[model samples]
Target: MDANHLINTLFPQGAEIDFDGEFFTGTGQVGDKIVAVLGTQGGVYIGVELAHRMAGIVLDTVRNHPGRPILLLVDTKGQRPSRRDELLGINGYMAHLAKCLDLARRQGHRTIGLVWSQAVSGGFLASSLLADECYALPDAEVRVMNLPAMSRVTKIPLERLEALSLDNPVFAPGVENYRRMGAIRDFWQGDLAACLATALDSPTGPDRRRAHGLEREGRLMAYKVAERVRHDPV
Candidate 1:
């Protein structure tokens, strides 16, 4: 009936489940439509696998429920940080998620994204990026790259990176920065109940990719990458 009860039913604490290796199912209704929330704050490998499972759920739901909308709650930190996951086709796992999202979209279901917390890199790409519409809590720490991790990977000193982030929001981490990047359309400024109400009330077919400036960002970057890919198809 309430959100807490709903969440508990979906994710009962002390329940033993292989979060990284299996599909967990919970059912609720979006108006007349039965909605399912798949996955957790688990790492990337599990997130990608969950995405595929979500897709399968969507297909089956559509067949049974006909035209109900699907809402996806995203709170991933990225793919699994494991050497084996990397070696054993991480790219393929991501592709599986992508294919599932495409299938959901083509079937005409209103696929929506709710980012409750950290949504970074490949995990974000696998789920939220494919949604028809997306929203995040105002306090949601959304980013393509976390600053510390980015600093380490980029080999930039943390202090200098922090200074650069003040001016370069792209490298900064926060909900507002994601808004600027066009990564998400709305922020949940109101309370959870109000926000969920708004989400249910809001029209789902809003032009997302273009409005978020992400399409432009990708188009501009596409040329540089395209040239290199054309030169070397590897």
Candidate 2:
């Protein structure tokens, strides 16, 4: 969906935002409350510039917004896979952005990530995956890497990975696969405004993706293994 249209649907009451075809920053109204909005669009690659800009927004929100909620609208292909970005330490910039969002959460600002479009690789990791609760639109595409790419990286045959993805949520891409893996809390359908509101009102908790993965049968042993590790005696 177009970013402007999505903003309107989410904040029917109106939002004070700025989008320059790639990055956006501003405040959005949600009933009696206001949320700090930061995001990317047009399937932009998350380069150092974009990562730094987003980190600044998060830090500013933490310092100025007090306890207001934050809404992250994600739509990125991934981090910029370029020699220029690599030379400039793009990973460090992405980490800074992630840290800023974590700071906001620790300071009592509710952080919610909504993947309105595509979210992949490091872009998703530094944004939506860092949120307290990450949700996605029904049509959103979320993935770390496609099967072919995974095959190249892991040296597994493309055919084998494709076959595994048929029954393994972790190896596939899509909102349903991610939901089954518990990376996505839920889908934002029906009423988007109400969905945002509910997310803001939702209580924050420790990461529950592993437990959700187990319950949904996407990853059967992750939760149990984590529990055993947590309780293991050194």
The TM-score obtained by model 2 is 0.95
lDDT of 1 by residue, 1-234 (tens): 322333444333312223333334455543344555554553334533455565676667667765556666656777666777677787687777767766767777667777765687787877777787777777767776767888899899999989977756567788776666666777765355445545666776644554445453522353455557779855
Once model 2 is optimally superposed onto the true structure by TM-score, how far is the C-alpha of residue 222 displaced, in angstroms? 1.9
Q: Model 2, poorest ten-residue lDDT window?
A: 165-174
lDDT for predicted candidate 2 compared with the true structure: 0.91
Q: Measured by TM-score, how close is model 1 to the native structure?
A: 0.72
Model 1, CA-based lDDT? 0.62
Q: Each model's TM-score?
A: 0.72, 0.95
131-230, model 2: which lDDT tens digit per residue? 9999999999988888788889999999998888787787778789999988899999988999999988888999999999888888788899999999
